[model samples]
Target: MNQKLKKQDWTVRVLQELERQYSPSRWSHRMSADDVIKAHVKALKEGTEQARDLAQTLLNVPYGEGDGEKLDVYIPKTNSLDVHLVVYLHGGYWQFLSKEESGFMAVPLIDKGVVVVAVGYDIAPKGNMDLMVSQVRRSVVSVVQQYSHISGLYLCGHSAGAHLAAMVLSTDWSQYSITPQIKGAFLVSGIYDLLPILSTYVMEPLKMTEEVAVRNSPSKLVPQLKLSSSSCQIVVAVAENDSPEFRKQSEEYYKALEESGLSVTMEDVANTDHFNIIEQLVDGEYHLTKVHR
Candidate 1:
């Protein structure tokens, strides 16, 4: 076979393998995948509703001029000088969820005087991968600028959201006016490399090409990451029951960060799948939630 045909053949085989490995719902050990997702969404909605009632929320605050470039900010009831802000990115394969269901994790954090910002970005079918990544990066910059008085800035994301958070960490902040002082990051069940996604149905709506995937892949962008905050801590956590590919990506990404001399750790949360792994963030006592605090 010619070079071009050989490459195409390899791509076909990789895609077939990824299709099985990347399908989280298929590997779910809990209830049916659909039921698990439904329960997860319900939890997110209820938790966010409770968070709104508990905190002084600033809803739909625009970070950029675009309609989807808005975020929901949850502020603690008691004002303190030592405020920590956490920017959360929701994951629905970069297409499904929205900020409306993103603030669930704030319920526990807010009571402890942590400000949580649930970011809104244009998801797939409407927004491309590049645009989503840019929006997330810009949202963090906007949050940092808006809350300049904040003592610490942190980041958290689930699945696709985690991917975006990683991208934000690997950002070339020189393009922006201010570089955010990110203190810590929590990445849960995320996809670090996008090449495998190209062959999966998940990429159908996002329409990412090989070059686009390569450019946005955090696993590939570790060299460009500006680790200005030597103390910045990155926790790459994977669900116990997550698909093999998901765990592989988190492990690989953690290794890459460790090799780069960045402060990073890997967490294998026990007895959890992709959906519940993040849904548990609503619980204050959850292992990952405790780490967030």
Candidate 2:
């Protein structure tokens, strides 16, 4: 084949590999995709109950006018210092999950004298990427405003939620009349770029266009940080069993931030897949939680 044809063929193969790598069904031997999802929901339900019994919690506080624009706040019973806040956004490819599944990580953080906020936003088909992004932004601002005594804010997200968390890092805080009080962010198994996802089977319901994909990609949207000190505080992490594309995306995002003079750390989480990596947060000693602390 001619060199031109060879290059075109290679591009097609690369795209195919990306789709295969990202499709959770392809990795179902370890656990079925359906089971992985069920595990999350089960953990969330258990955690929600535990959160109520273990800590003082406020449920379904509205942050926006939308039906899903609400958050669950978990507060520790005992604390000697000004408590900080850790806001979690759950992932379901921006379509499948809810804030109800977000409380699984709350008990551990709350135990450390940190307030945990699990945010809810409308998912896809019913809600677009723009709407989800906006709701999360509004939720963050609302949380900060609601709790005036917070020492700082930390953002944690998994998968698509990680994408949204990265978007939060790029936010123009001036627009909301709020200072960027976010002290750090832990982005786990996230999709930083949506371009590859658009070509994958998952995008059918997301109905993403090239324009939307490019515009919302966190890898492509790293903002100029106002302070040098604030840049390095973000942590970018990927799991041992995460697909090659997922790991690559995380590395690429970390490089982009570093090259832009932003302070970012890249971590390889061992002995876990995409699903269990976030679940690790349920255990306080898990490296994922350590990163946040």
The best candidate by lDDT is 1
Work out the TM-score per prediction.
Answer: 0.94, 0.90
What is the Å distance of residue 156 in model 1 from its true position?
A: 0.1
State in Å the error of residue 216, model 2.
0.8
lDDT of 2 by residue, 1-293 (tens): 69999999999998888788886534534677778768767876787677777878899999988888999998898655588888999988988878877887876877788889999999988889988888898999899889888888889999999999988877777688686578888899899889878878788778989998888888776653434126438898988888888889999998988887776889998887888788768788988787778
Query: How far out, in Å, is residue 61 in model 2?
Result: 0.4
Model 2 Cα displacement at 76 (Å)?
Answer: 1.0
Candidate 2 residues lying further than 4 Å off, grouped into runs, are: 1-16, 79-81, 225-232
| Model 1 regions lying over 4 Å from their true place | 1-16, 226-230
lDDT per residue as tens, model 1, 1-293: 59999999998898788887887877778888788888888989999998998999999999999999999999998757779999999999988989999889989998799999999999989999999999999999999888878998999999999999999988888899998888899999999999978878998898899999999999998877745545679999999999888999999999989998999999999999999898888899999999888
Error of 2 at 189 (Å): 0.5
What are the lDDT scores of the predictions, listed in order? 0.90, 0.82
Which one is best on TM-score? 1
